[model samples]
Structures are given as C-alpha cells and as structure tokens.
Target: MSENDPLLNDPLLDEPQARRRWWKPSFDRRRILRWSLRGVVALLVIAALYYPVGMLLVHKIDDDPDFQAPATPEGASRAVALAAALIDREVGDYGWPSNDPFFMPGWALDNMPNYQQGIIAALARFSTEMRDQIGRVRGTSQVDPDLEKAAGQLSYSPTVWIFDFSTSWAPTASSEQQYLAAAKTLRSFNNRLSQGQAVFERRADNLQGTLDRIAADLGSASAVLDKQVEEHSGDWVDFQADDIFYATKGRLYAYGLLLRDLGTDFAPVIAERDLKAAWAQMVETFRVASTLDPLVVVNGRPDAFMRPSHLAAQGFFLLRARTQLREISNILQK
Candidate 1:
C-alpha cells in the first residue's frame, strides 16, 4: 500500500493526529514577513525619536568645548572626532569609547614636555592653542593660585599680559585690534606731569613727618640722658651703660639719615615736569619693582632666599603656573 493510501491510514495514526500542536506547526512566509515588518517599524520609530538625541550624545562625547580647549575651533577638531570613529570600527574593543582614561588608554598623550621631530609643526598647534587661551582672559580677575604665586614671586604684573606694549603686541588678527584698543583705554594716560608729581610730593612730606617724630623722640631721650649725667656730679663709671647709650644714639642718627635720604629721593618722583613723562617714569619704576624675583623661602640675609623659582629658571613649574592662571583667568572672564 502507498503511504497516502487510505488502507495505510490506521486508527492509531488518526489518534496521534487528533492530539496535534498548533505552535509546532510548519513555518509560514506570511507570518515571518509580518513579524519582520513589525520589527523594522519599531526600529524606525526608535531611530526617529533618537536621531537628535544621538547627535547630542555624539557631540558631547567627541566635540565637547572643554575637552577641545586649547585646540583650534576650526575643522581640525571635527576631523579628529571622525578619525576616532573610523578607528573604532576596526578594533571591536574600542568601538564605543568611554571617557575614562583607564578604559580608553589609547587617548593618553605622551611626553608633553618632549619635542617631536618626525612630526613637523606638531608643537605649533599646541602653542597656537596657548596663545588663544591667553587672549580669552581679559577684564576678569580669575586668579590661579599656582600662577598667581609664581607671578607674585616674580612680581609679574597680571595687567602686563595686556599692558606691556613691547611684549604684549597683538597678533595680526582682527581680534587683536580690539585688544589693542582695550589696552589703550585701560592705560588712559594723561599728557601733563602734575598728577604724579603731586603724589610724589605727598610721599616725601610723609617721610618728613616721620623724620620729625623720630627727631623728637631722640631729642627727648638725649635731654634725659644729659639731665641724668648732671644729677650724678661724681659719676660711678658705668662702662656698659656708656656703650649702650652710644649704640642707641648711633642707631638714632642712622635712622634720621635714612629718613632724610628717602625724603630727598621721593622729592624727585614728584618733580614738576611733563606729567606724561612722570607717569611713564613712575610706571616704569613700579614695573621694575614687579620684575624683581620673589623670595620664596627665608634666608638669613634680608634679600636671600632658600629656593628660587622663576619662569626662566623653573620652566616645568612655570608651565603648571601658566595652566593654573589660564583656568583662573577664564573663570574670572566669565
């Protein structure tokens, strides 16, 4: 009998057919197509909702302004981000980057202090970034402790970053003209010599007043000494007393001379000359004072320091100081 023959269809076979399962039925093309279409539609809806959201995420991960600081704002940063994405394609582990340096160690930059010869003009970009960061911090007093401390030690003027015409020359850019104008306004220098001259005279007068007080104190002390000596007609000689008395008198005389010289020096600072000239000269003198190296540690001598650090001397520490200053000044500007 044939397999499809009715004679072969036994009662037991019919019983098994009666207990049939629906889920275990043969696969259907229509069912598969329907499910596939449903899946695709779901994906489309999700993508439509997340397209802008994904853009935001991408921007945050790769194009964050803070992350790209000290970098040029042109196409280079975008190129970097694209190149990063392509590199991730080849390496399965690097596909989705985590900002954690530990997880994505490839981004770790090496030898920031070292120069690269094979890569020509690599440092050019970094220096350009630094120049830009410096300009961004104007009018704000965001002070970096490290840079402030370092600049304070060197007496480097914060305003010098803007004011020093010789060194603070603006770059050949449109923005620089504005900076130059600001610098000029901030200076607002007067043409006449009278103002600084007047200030200098006041300082000199103060010195004179101080000198008069010291003179009075000394005179009173001197009279008392003379009267005491007169009281003792037959003096029991005190050798140490004479030494102490003479030393005190000598100190007073030296102090008086110092005050007189200071007054004399101050008299010239306010001399009635070209007012602009006086201002310029006074500013220059203050600049000179600011340039004096700061004494970081106390030495036995008045001008001596235990350890000296400066921009030219301790370059590494100075770099750190500069970075701190950049951050501080940025905050202040905001």
Candidate 2:
C-alpha cells in the first residue's frame, strides 16, 4: 500500500484506470456526464417527441372559475383579470406557456380568469370602436349575414381560458406541501359553497315552516274571535253586529300588523341569506372555476390565460355563465 511500492512502479500507474464502485453507476462517469452535459439536446429530443407546437393545448380538465373566486372585489378582480389577460395576450398566442419559461411565472395562473377576462374586455372595446368602420362599406355588412350575426352575437360573449396548474406541472416550494395546500384551498372553497347552499335551503325550509305556522295561528285565532263576536250578538243585536264588525276589522288589522312584523324582521336576513349571500358564495364558485385555465383560440391556436382578446374573455364569460347556471340550478333544487 506504500506509494513507493513495486506495484506502483508498473506502467499502469502512469495512467488512471476507469473504475466503478458498488455505490456508483457502472457506466463511465464521463459517459454519465455526457448525458448531463447534453442538457439542451435532451430537452430538444423531449420537445420533438411530445410537441405542443401544433394547436396550443390550452387546458386539461378546466374547473369552473366561480368556485375559485380570488379573495377580492369586482373592481380589484377586474384589475387582476386584466393583468392576467395582458400576460396571456402578450404570451399565450405565442405559446401555451409551452415554452415552460412563462408557464407558471409566479402570478400567471393565480390571476387567470379576472386578469385575462379584463384583457378580453379591453380587446372587445377596441374591436367595438373598429366595428364602426363597417359603415364605410355600403351593403357589405348585408352581404355577410354571418359576419353581421357574429358582430351582434359578440356583444356579450366574453371568452376566457382557465388552466389548473398543480405543483405537479411545475416545481414549487415544498411541492407536495404546496399541492396539499392548493387542494385544501379548493376543498375548503367548495365546502363553503356547499355549506352556504345548505344554509340557504335550511333557511328556506324554516321560513316555509314559519309561514305555515303563522297561517295556522291566524286561522285559529280568527275562528275564536269570530265566535266571540257571534256569541255576544244577542246583547244589542244590531249594536253587537256593528261592534262585532269593528272588532273583526281590528282583529284583521292586528293580524296584518303581525304578518308585517314577521316579514320586516326577516327580509334583510333573507336578502343576506339568499341573494347577496348566495351571490357571494356563487361568486366564489366562479372564482375557483376562473382560476382554472380555460382554453381559447387566438390566431387559430389555443392559448391559456393569454391576453384579453375577444376569444379569451368570451371563453371566460362562457365558462362563468356555465358555472353560474350550474350553481343556480343546484341552489334552486336545494
């Protein structure tokens, strides 16, 4: 084992031999380094194989945006949405974040629906102003009814694309933990909507029961009051009749006052419970849904939370409408 040993004097000692250890890979370390060194080359091979170069696959399974409403107001939501749209407009048409460079760029998916929807709104306004140019060409609009129809139909259609980016798609801080958090957020939001609906249905049922009880009470009380008047009619036949008449009028007045009191007490509560509260709950459903990357075509290619073009915004609206409808139907049934 001595450095000056006769074995070290051999010609083999002049050069290093390729060696392997049980703990290490058998291939030449250099060969392993060769693949590592060929980084871009390996990426190119992967790109060529599962190319997203064709129609941009803007989505996988897009959830409804309402359920994932960002924790913000309408104006703030619009601003966030516009920013998202701007990114998509600037980035999506070029690629579906297929470049991987901008795919999960911090705020992209976070601001998907509102940000991108805002983009669509801006583009629609621009397109609207440009629509006047059609007047310059006489009868041209008439010739293309489909174009005219499309223009008219485009009035409210706001297209939006939503993509659900899991930590699986891209690395995040403690990806497993982050995924769990995102999943929890989704489940929590969903549960909130569910609980809200449950609350609404229960309130509706309770109110219906209250009304039924009130009606029964009113009927029973009316019968007793009417009988009291009828029994005393003989005291001063005509006088009792008039007093009875006035007493019944007072009783009706009392009944009406009680009903009014019940309604006045409950109206605001119902408003909050049913409409405004339901709406807020529903909005969250849209929010969650919007967080999803809804795919839309731009320049004949699908794109993600891309810029606020007509296509992207309209996609959002469609998605929103679909979600709202589902929620409405669900709430109604509940």
Best by lDDT: 2
Single out the weakest 10-residue window by summed lDDT for candidate 1: 111-120
lDDT of 1 at 104: 28
lDDT of 2 by residue, 1-334 (tens): 4566555556654423312222344568897788787997888887664434322334222222221223432212122222223323333432222223343332122222323233333333222222333211332332222222222332433221232343245533331222223223323323433444211112343333433433343344345434543354223222323222222222222222222322333455446546455445433433432343323312211232433222223334334433443443344345
Error of 2 at 69 (Å): 15
RMSD of candidates 1 onward, in order: 27.6, 27.9
Residue pairs whose backbone atoms clash in candidate 1: 142-328, 153-294, 192-275, 193-274, 193-275, 197-270
